[model samples]
Target: MLAVLVSLLPLVRVLPGCHCQSTNATAAITATTVTSVVSGSLTSKVGGYAVFDCPVPLEYVTRRSRPLVIRWTKNGHTVFTLSGGSLTTDERYEGRTSIVEPPEFSDAIATSINVSSLRESDTGDYECFATHKNRDLQLTASSQRPPLPSSQPLSHQSSTASTLSAVGTDIVDAGVRIKLDVQGGDIMSIPPINQTRLEHESVHFSCVKEDLESTVQWYKDGVPLDDLPILNGRFNVSLEGSLDIYDAGLNDNGFYLCRIMSAKGTFSAGAFLNVQYKAKIVYSPAEVFLAFGKPGTLDCHFHSNPPLTKIRWEKDGFLFDTYNVPGVYHKLNGSLYFNRVGKEHSGKYTCTPFNDLGTEGPSTPMDLIVQHPPKLIVVPKVLYFRKLGDNITMPCEAENVDNKSPAIVWQKADGKSLFDPRVTVAGGNLTLTGVKSEDRGVYRCVASNIAATISAETELIVEESLFHQKNFGLHINSTKKNIVAYWKRPYSFCTVWSRDTSLKLSNWNATATSSDGKAILWNLNASKEYEIMVSCREEISGESLFSKSILIHPKVAESDQLSLQELNKSTGPVTDSFDIRVERSGGNYNVSWTFTDNSRKDQADVERYQVKWYDAFDGKELGTASTEANKRHIGR
Candidate 1:
């Protein structure tokens, strides 16, 4: 267990992102070979088998038939296999496991084993202990990744080796590849998942008939459970289709079937069982690419039969903490978390899991890559000023690319391309050589990369410079259901800019115009954010330019009526409360007051209300505190 924790430290750094709620891409199928302890686990469904292939060649340790004496152990070296001479086996794994028979070599027999009739308790690290030339040798068969053969030769080995308990041997690191052959089941009567329990714990499996009065039968590994001598007749031998082993032992683990004969038909459904000591890591993501700047959880899922006692997390190698780094920490739910992701958060990550029922073993490690989104380092101004025939440029810059520069595009507010000869768009900037009245429109720069996309808006007003500041302003706001836009009579025209927020490109930047003074732009697209700007002009053509610019934004109403501010006007202070007096007490210059708080009367002991101590000269607060009604006077 200590060896696993030491190997997993120094995995990852810092990150800033959401809790991995949203995803912009599908998982790219990663074809990785089985190499490390993390990727060498052999996974097989319940009641199946898994194979472990050692990296040592058949010729490495072959000395006829009795070349090397070998044993297999799990969870800190509790012997699962004691194959010294007469093929001895642990009680928990009896009759279901065996040394591979082939190659006609003695060392080949000890190098590999087939773990068959698997139950949930079999989910853990498995290591081999052997006696070669009187020198103790150890090789581990463990991984958490999908089984794939290693590209390296048989002599290939990983430099990193994990330490097992009761060390008295020379450890040899080897990769193990595991393949799981899964078979589906019917949904008629869902059977319980495979069970793993300690000695004397209860075990149950039942498959009832469509007709309660029908006959039923129970079988364990094709044999009647009642004949199990290890149970010592502690099990119920009735033919009622319910099998219970409350006082279970290691020999009781095997395939259990509850067969029922009903009017519909005769069918069988059941679960498997195995004896285990404590808990073990069952599942977790081998890799995760969380969005940068968004909060995310590094998943490290695990399971235990007797209920887990605790879990410890380690990242990029030291114990994970929020001390030096503020937002990163370990969670009790078997996952590391971050309030946000930063660039320094790129690296490998791992989890050290173990089960401490009567023994302990280290867990597999995982590596995940987090992708970061691009950022707009420089954005265009919200409004731009220009004169006739004068050149104009809107510089838009972006940074934080995912290994490459972000793609930049320039377009009008109405989703039309600005590819005219007068308009030159290079990268994120737009340059207009000769400004005209027609160019007086809203434009934006869009920058995007694999991680995310961002944009900024800027409006060019060439015709506005021809007109003087009229000193008049227009106010705008929205109600719950309507976009009420109105102005005085001299306002010759009003323009409404809207876009369907539901990603419908056909309705992008839809506009509405009215000429009869009061432009009540109502019944808008329910999903639109209307940018209603009203401009006035004396005449439609012949140098009678439109009034400067009256841009107003319609906001979602937070209350009865949402009053928007007119950016063109200067106003005084807006307040809804009154000031108080600070009394001069007998030349000591103390202040006191008695104020009543009629509101929130239901909440007692809450009043000394708005009393404050002010300097009276500078009109700034000097001291402040609430006075309790129980005591009226305060001593100096």
Candidate 2:
């Protein structure tokens, strides 16, 4: 038994104060020895394996009486163990671990623990211990329990024996520390950073990772920004991996990168820094007044860093569009143009500038006033007739008239101003009361304003009121041999004239001068149409007023017979109670009639009657008049 235990003791270098002893006097134990085959750090990619070797010298294996116990531990935890040539692994490293000692190296006592599929958690300090036991040398009875001094007390003897036993157990246990770093796994990945700051504003950017033990460095535009000479004092990086800028300007804008490096790997992320600026209006249009039918333009000039994306125009409080007015359109440069301006085009205009960032600055409004001439909508009548001591009225109207009430004026054709007490003008109307002959002339109405002046003319005619009688009693008696005519005198002295209308010849003998307004015909024609006219004159002034002409016919009795020459001539029936005569003046003709009942009892009563006139040369009927009275006057 002693020899077998002796052979199992591993050869190892012992510490100076460590000693091994056995309880049996014949059994002797040798000191254990530990050796390392691999040491220091070892790095490998994730999902790979690493081997840690613990080698013992061949001389120690040959001298061993029993197989050594080999153990592998990581960070103070058991990983694998081998005893009596049998391998046992801890539950933590079950399938992915092995302790191998090749058959070729059996005598050498070299062994290794293979850690398969290394992970980040496997990175730590590792150690291996080769332990063996033997029972040969004996501990002297005096060494186990030292004799107490002759004068010392015996009560502390139990404590001394327990101390000796602990010292012996420690001397036999031995181990070696081996360090191998198994690194290579996921590293910290910084997220992208985007920051914006206004001009002259401070900004900060951070690249931090809480899950990794790493240090971060920043770069700008693919260049190191930490020690750049250009950013001497304006920029800095904080201990927590933050880059801060003080009073940033346009020059600080660029792409930035944050790089992180650790024992595992290296990773990088990028960020874009932007310096913003507010939009400003450099120039704006001024107030303008465009004439009618003239073109106009309004411009709004602006400046911005990111450039303007859109621009809009407004009129009054409404948005401006192409349909707002004809010939109006917008330009890309924030300007509005009008091909032709009118009253509807007049308004307040404003331009709004916008960008991707936002709208900035105040807009200036402009006023547009369109000037146009006054247009006449209504005018007075062209001709007006009025009797003496009558009133006359003329009206004129205009659109877009001046603010002043009296923008219209009335004047005569002779350039005589007619604005007087007799003529009142109000609301574009002119009225004249108690009109006389002097007021008979062409008058003009003139409208004037700041834009333009226009005028219209009208004529008025006035006549004296001398004739007052409604009817003239004219009667004619005719027979087969002679004809006579008389009338109730409207004036003191008058003259009578007779004519044959069919022959267009005057009857000189039938014409007479009458003081009592009576006349007789000496020569007469039967079954012939004759017209008689009477004129009444003032003896002093020779002013004359004519009565209506009378149409008469002299006829023979029903039993009368005519010669063959007279029978061949055509004649019309004689009318006894009704007479009609027409006299033409200007474009119109005046017709008058007088009637007296002379029919027999059997004749029908006149329910209605119509007077007709005919053209003398063509014998064509011109017009007809209907009346129920005995006398009528018609003007056509």
Best lDDT goes to which candidate?
2
After aligning candidate 2 to the native by TM-score, how far in Å is the CA of 59 from where it should be?
A: 99
Residues 1-636, candidate 1, lDDT per residue (tens digit)? Answer: 112211211111001110111122111112132112222233223333443434332334344635465655566555444343345667776655555543432233444455444444555655555556665544422232122222211100111211111111223543222222222222123223356678778876544333556667777778776676666567763344466777876567676776666666665555677776555555655666667888877776665545556565656775554456778876766567778877666666655555567323434556556677668888886556577898998999888555678888887875566878998877768899998878876787888764567788777767445344342244444543334455555555544444334444422231445564433333353224543444443343212223333333444454422232331122211111111222324434333332234322323534444334333223356655555542223234
lDDT, each prediction: 0.48, 0.56
Tens-digit lDDT string for candidate 2 (1-636): 121112112121112112233222222222221111121323332223444444333333332535666677888988778667667887655555555444543444435455543445566766667665632221111113221111111111111111011111112224544444433335432243456688789887655543446777778887888656666688876665667888876678887776767765565555567887666577655666565676767677776657777777788978887766679887777677889877888888777777777667546877776766566678986556578898988999777633433278788876667867898988788899999877766778888764457888876655453223224476677655445667887678665656787875443222555666565453335467787656565454334444566788656555554542353243222234344444444555555544435433212455556666544334357777777764455455
Hey, what RMSD does candidate 2 come out at? 39.4
Q: After superposition, how far is residue 566 of candidate 2 from its true place, in Å?
A: 30
TM-score: model 1 vs. ground truth:
0.28
Q: Residue 525 deviation, candidate 1, in Å?
A: 38
In order of appearance, the predictions have TM-scores of: 0.28, 0.22
